[model samples]
Target: MKSATQDKRVFTEQETSHYIGMSRSFLRQSRMEGLRKNRTQAPPFIKIGRAVRYLKEDLDQWLDSHRKMHQLPHEGGAHV
Candidate 1:
């Protein structure tokens, strides 16, 4: 059994931003852009009426999808 906090499946925008290390405004802007573009620009979210919520699993997946490997110095840039 898990505690309520530990079992939380939905999070508010602010909580998602903090959990993902992004600013609230950034998330907001992304959502706005997504609306105008008719595409999702940020992590998947749920719209519960006027509130936006993010799932922990979705956030984790989004972060994983965005993972990048750092380029070795010799692998990029100067050929000299």
Candidate 2:
């Protein structure tokens, strides 16, 4: 048996942003863009009525899916 505090893994928008080193706007834009493009790599979030939350596992998977290889110096200009 776990306490409510111990079982809680869902993160608020701000917390998620802080954890991922992104802004809330960045997360929101990513989510919206994914939906518009029908992409599955977007961070999966839960909407409980008007309240939104993100699961740690989902965020982690999303980060993993977006991983990229290192580029040589001046290989390419950073985008986003």
Identify the candidate with maximal TM-score: 1
Candidate 2 local lDDT, 1-80, one digit each (tens): 85453355898888888777788987888777776545344478999998889998887877887787885577467667
Judge candidate 2 against the unseen true structure and give its global Cα lDDT, from 0 to 1: 0.76
> In model 1, which regions exceed 4 Å deviation?
1-6, 35-40, 70-80
Candidate 1: 10-residue stretch with minimal lDDT: 32-41
Candidate 2, run of 10 with poorest lDDT: 34-43
- lDDT scores for all predictions? 0.81, 0.76
TM-score of 2: 0.64
Output the TM-score of candidate 1: 0.71
Question: How many residue pairs clash in model 1?
Answer: 0
